[model samples]
Target: MSRKKTNIEKEIRALKKRLAKKQSRKRKVRIVARSVISKSKTVIFDPCAICGVREATTRDHVPPKAIFPQPRPTMITVPACSECNNGASDFDDLFKVYLSMQATGKSEIATRLFKERTVRTLQRNKSLLAKIKAESKSLLVENTEGESEEKLGVLWDSEAHDHVVERTIRGLYYHHSKKVLANDAELKVQWLKSIPEEIESILELLTEQVIGDDQVRYKYYIAPEDPRHSVWLFDFYGAHYTSGYTEPTDS
Candidate 1:
């Protein structure tokens, strides 16, 4: 072969070697990821986080992955049964829509998720849209001048919201305590936009700490003796807030 032909062959061989190295590195990274996931699953052994009866067969993200930006680096997962894991998708979608509508400009993540996931979900599930529309109502409130003003808002589905809250509490409880909650433990949920005076006093009595940043923050207070009885406060986008509590069934 001529000099130019030999040089071309050598360059081609060099490129192939580089490509092979890149592919091998990618395979190694994938193997590591799988190993991490497997180890995480083994770390928690418990019944379903929701019903607390059946054995947990699947690991579930505390907040569904759909609510977060693509490729969320560190997601919190909890032990869960198949039903609790899969059944919450519709509620999660609805919650995202409500959160996005309320968020508007406060959170870039919420805005992007609204456009990408919520809108598409609404378009696909016409019944969900109708349900939301049907539940919407208007109320008349008096102004400073004693004039009635119309206020409009969507009526939230309490059952669905409660489901999300309960699951989240269970996940956080396990994440923090590294112990499964009792199967007979009862959870009480209350959705609040601001901390009630009573709750504030209770928080003062318990341990308090904040997690995450302005975009998403969790301010929680857990009783030292019984974690099941605790207060969880979630702040999204530094604007929307939802607070709730879980207590023993008898309490």
Candidate 2:
């Protein structure tokens, strides 16, 4: 009985050792695979990522600081020239309000932005309020009670949302892949209301990056051969989702 017990103990110890070695190998393999597939590289912004024409004099926050509440999250900024940075100021303000309104129900932070800053901005900027009221459309949408109610919804101008998102995509592309997207590379943008089946599948396979307590969530895939060919799924405040791609244009 003693002899048999000793043999079993030896076998058990050997099995554990083998298992540990196997797991270690698996871990290393996974690390190598992820590194190779993702091609995560350090970003350097000597020249502006936007225009690529002028030297980067300042850093511009991708989503803009106005989009967040007080004591904002660690800034996610990219290199930009004074011209690009200053030109985007008004657009950033407008984006904050529009984003807050659309994403009010998405998260607590979003709610705070809407109640805290958005309202104040509207109060101060009557022209902006007038513009919104002018562009809004009355539509019959089903409420929680399953009854159709006439509600007013803002019909966002393509320029209103596209410009900010375009800049964001460029910044993120440079951040992740360390590739500056040229001006010739045209961006295709789609603000997704209901995600398509095919796109949903693709999104699952991409690398995910979330910023500032779920303020901005990005799932992206960049081609290994050409970083310019990249696909992005951007979720803002959990309510708004945008799918965009930067592809090489004929130009």
- TM-score against native, each model: 0.67, 0.76
- Model number with the top lDDT: 2
In terms of lDDT, model 1 sits at 0.60
- Model 2 clashes, total count: 0
Q: Give the Å shift of residue 240 in candidate 2.
A: 1.5
Q: Write the per-residue lDDT of candidate 1 for residues 1-251, one digit (tens) a residue.
A: 67765554444334323323322111000000111226457443456655565567898888666566564537778877798789888777777777665665566766766678777888998998898789878889776799999965677776666667667767777777765555435555555554444334333333443332344567564555555555566666664666555545564
Candidate 1: deviation at residue 235, Å?
1.9
Best model number under TM-score = 2
After TM-score superposition, what is the CA distance of residue 241 in candidate 1 from its true location, in Å?
2.5
Clashes of each: 0, 0
Question: Which stretches of model 1 miss by more than 4 angstroms?
Answer: 1-45, 71-73, 137-152, 197-213
Residue pairs of candidate 2 with colliding backbone atoms: none
lDDT value, candidate 2, whole model: 0.70
